[model samples]
Target chain A: MAGIFKVKAKAKDGVTKVKMLAKHVMETGQRKDKKTGEIIPAKFIQEITVQHAGNTVFSGQLGTAMSKNPYFSFTFTGGAKGEELSISWTENTGASATETAKIK
Target chain B: MTMHRRTVVKAMLACGALVGLGAVIPGAAFAARNKDAFSSDDQAKAMQALFDAEPANSQDIVLKAPSIAENGAVVPVTVSTEMTGVESISIFVADNPTPLVAEFMIPAGTKASVATRIRMGKTSTITAVVKADGKLFSTARETKVTIGGCGG
Candidate 1:
């Protein structure tokens, strides 16, 4: 469904470049609200992985130090046109989602 | 949290029943078992928890970052290496409360290059550690932060 993640992937000369942007608050649990002065609970993407043809291309384990709305780019070999890259992520709060994109 | 657990169970059932399980990679393959590493705060201990080894400084590992960052909330960092058989690439901000920022696993066919954004509390030395062929190599660069990102 492409929810929470936007991806652009293209393959050329046996190399595929994939770039994605994820919508996340990435609260570090250190920031305090101006009005209430209450500390925000820590919440962020703990793990993210991308796979093609049943093989993992890239995987990341993140911390609260990552910026909000995380963006990432990497390249892998052997992907082809019209193939789908499956992305899945799990956050610290236990929420997770899986999405797919077609390689151009 | 009861409602959340029920929803998760429902989703698991749906995923197990309908999908062919072809491309559905198991979470264990790249699971987040480094919660302690993420919260270690100390760079040396965090590195030990993450890689379980002391990284040897290497010039082959290239870490690119701004010499001066205008905003600490979002600083772009890139790590690349010419080394082959790269296992993973990890980012560390020495002065952050939690020094370890992120760790990326590079599969066999993937290139040893990664780019992402991170948060910095203030000016600090950022390091990129790469594990290749069962050995760790590292490089570091100093980034001057104009504004602190983490308000403590």
Candidate 2:
């Protein structure tokens, strides 16, 4: 599903800090079937990557164990004011999303 | 022959009683277990590989979370670390379906601070893993959610 993502980047003292929020269900699929009493299958975002100035600085593999609407904040070096950063992810079913922001 | 028939009937009645009891007991127990859920072994192992161990307590790390969350859908969490040479920061909800919530790699020569909102299916311990200069440091806090967020 197409979800909402927000990215904010701020630069100070030659460093850039980025904060991102992505909306998702992040279902673990272990929930019980209320009527039949069986476990549901797991589904969640499997991979996430953040790129700054064409270099991969951060990456992670998330499982169904993560809570819904995952949010992340981190900092990186060497980004001048107004540099563009790209954040992207691929869900378990191969669905993908990307959000970009400029250093402020 | 009559004794044999009596024995068979008694055994059948006992089996029926056992099945009925099993159905009722497990339902109640499952409900109780659902109230507090954590990741399975494999899931925990997967998270462990991605997460570096953080010792139970540290003075340099500050974990900010509500003492009690009225709603599980959105619980604000903030982790700020003062340790020098910090490399990364990560957050994990111990009792959520997925224990690995988010991992962040802090580039060299950058400040170590992260703040965000996360969902909590139920009451859980939130852990912060901080990687600094090739080593790991950590802290945690237990957050109680009155209403479940993920519909557990």
Candidate 3:
């Protein structure tokens, strides 16, 4: 399945900079459903992992405090043009998705 | 400057040794996510669940956060450190309904820096904790939230 993430990696000066935008509702449990008036259960991406050339480069755990459609950016050493980079995320609901990009 | 370099070198050597040891133990580069900490309203409980021990104050980590957040819903936070072998970095808000905001794992050769936004329920002490070479270090700063976030 295609994950809802847009990633771009650019290698320059021996460093690779990565930027990503994820499409998610990031529903905070405190919000009440407009119709039902019941709290909307929290649903958010709880974990994210990034790999390059089969090696883990970055990972993070998130919570409901993050804004909707979270944006993330980071830089790491040792990346080359055309290298494979993958990002995978797991949500609180146990759903996960992975997307891949090629370093430029 | 020389003293600082010496300290950094010593720290790096210590980290190098620890990283070697971690390689021998599977899953040592990462820490399990603490769901309870994210759901906790108590700061102490959240800290315990996340680190299993109190973090020591440190001058190494640089935590940048607003002194007064005009909007608590999207308070920008950035954490950076020069410490090598940085295993992870975590953010926490003392007064939030759920104190623990996020945790990030920094792999080897990656810069120990991360930027993100977090919600603040009210005026709070925002803490940034860094785990480097199996040692926990932290720094905290107070930020006044003008508009409550997290559904007020």
Say which candidate scores most in DockQ.
1
Candidate 3 docking DockQ: 0.41
Candidate 3 ranges beyond 4 A from true positions: B1-31
Q: Which rank order by DockQ, best down to worst?
A: 1, 3, 2
**By TM-score: ranked, best first:** 1, 3, 2
**Which runs of model 2 end up more than 4 angstroms from their true locations?**
A1-4, A31-41, B1-56
- The window of 10 residues in a row where model 1 chain A has the poorest summed lDDT is A1-10
Give the alpha carbon lDDT tens digit for every residue of A1-104 in model 3.
48688888899998999887887888778988888888888889999999998889989999887767787777899999999899989988889988898899
Instruction: List native contact recovery per candidate, as a fraction of 1.
Output: 0.84, 0.44, 0.67
lDDT (10s digit) by residue, model 2, range B50-118 = 542434457679999998999887788888888888776767787776666666566555457777677
Segments of candidate 1 deviating more than 4 angstroms? B1-32
Query: Per-prediction TM-score, please?
Result: 0.86, 0.68, 0.83
Candidates 2 and 3 compared by lDDT, better number: 3
Q: Please give, for residues B1-152, the per-residue lDDT of candidate 1 as tens digits.
A: 99999999999998877653522333235444675577787999899978878999999988989999999999999999999999999999999999999999999999999999999999999999999999999999999999988884
Candidate 3 structure, TM-score to reference: 0.83
Give lDDT: candidate 1, residue A33.
Answer: 84
The CAPRI classification for model 3 reads as: acceptable
